[model samples]
Target: MLKIVYPICCGIDVHKNFVVATIATTDRENITTYRTKRFSTFTKDLRALALWLSNNQCVHICIESTGKYWIPIHNILEPSCQITLAHPKYVKAIRGKKTDKKDSIWIADLHKHGLVPGSFIPPADIREIRDLLRYRSKLVSFASSEKNRVQNSLTVSNIMLSSVVSDTFGKSALAILSHLLKHPDDQDFDFRPLLHGSMLKKQNDIALAIDGTINDIQAVKITLCLSHMDDIKRSYVARGTAF
Candidate 1:
């Protein structure tokens, strides 16, 4: 027979709206008893669950990592319980006979015999940093997408600014683009004043590039893309400052 590890332990089957918990208590006779309960995912009910576990003296707790549903429960019980977060595959219930109560009971029985292997959870501060970095990465991706949209708008509008400049979003390119956007109808306007440093040498090529016409619809699309890119840049900077 498997040796008893945690003589008294609890297992929680977490869900988005509710959770099923089972507490297993083993006696000197090697027989185990289970008390199962259902609780909502709300903060108050989770606190109540923590209190119930404390009352039963079940400090060792095991739970399956079901998406992000288990985070709130972990946050509520971390202070008083030694939580063991296991992958669902490690404690999954029998197929075709699966139920929340049965899942919790199975988890509790496994944990009672030290059969559950816990996943590695970083410290709270490290998790916070990880979340911030992930959000920043998403912002970067969004900004890149907006930039691509702007490039597509320019290309479809017959503007070839990208062919003449190394970075179409550079200061000199932006100046020329702003000028072209402001005067969509007048292509003969001198662009020399907009050129900077090495861009001055490409005045003739830049002029040929900006000679393309932009329709009202393309102009609006490009404007919106630029505005969204600017907003994303500001948000990224603000989040970096916070970090």
Candidate 2:
């Protein structure tokens, strides 16, 4: 027989709208009693559940980490209970039936036998920092995608901007492209005026690179990509500042 690590423990099957909880208790005679309850995933209901658990003298609680749904519940019960954030795969129903109640009971039984392995849950402040970092990472990825789109647009127009400049999205390249986009039909366009710093040395090459057939459609797409990149950059800076 498996030893009971926790003689009295509760298991919670978390969902988006509700949670199913099962409380199990084992006596000196090795007799076990199980009681189940359902609670809505609301603040009031969660508080009631906490009260019920407290009344039963149950402090050990095992909860399945189901997406973002478990965070709020964990927040509500963290102070009162010894919470174990278990992975759902580790608490799967290996026998009889598969229902919310059954899942909760199974988890409680597993916790009783010390079979539930808890997942790592960082402190609240660390979790907030992690969320901000993840958001910033996504923004950075989107900005890179937009940069690639801009480069691809330039390539499609037979523009050798990227081949000439180390970064096609650099300030010098953008200034040249802006001039070319504005005066698409100016065959005798003087690009020396847009060349700045070391770019002045490559005046002839920059002129040759800008000489491309960028039609109205390609120009519009390129403008949109640049605009989106600007917006992403602004957001990235703002998020970094927020951190």
Top model number, lDDT: 1
- For residues 1-243, write the lDDT of model 2, one tens digit per residue: 989899999999999999999999999877889999999999999999999999999999999999989988998999999999998899988876589998999999999999988998888889888998888788889888988888888888889888778878778888878876888887567777666678778877777777778899989988998899889878757766774
| TM-scores, all models, native as reference | 0.95, 0.93
* Model 2 ranges off by over 4 Å: none
The alpha-carbon deviation from the true structure for residue 5 of candidate 2, after best TM-score superposition, in angstroms, is 1.3
After superposition, the stretches of candidate 1 with alpha carbons farther than 4 Å from their true spots are none
Residue-wise lDDT of candidate 1 within 94-151, one digit each (tens)?
Answer: 7877888999999999999999999998989988889988888887888899999989
Q: What shift in Å separates residue 121 of candidate 1 from its native position after superposition?
A: 0.9
TM-score of 1: 0.95
Q: After superposition, how far is residue 167 of candidate 1 from its true place, in Å?
A: 0.4
Q: Pull out the clashing pairs in model 1.
A: none
lDDT of every model, 2 decimals: 0.91, 0.88
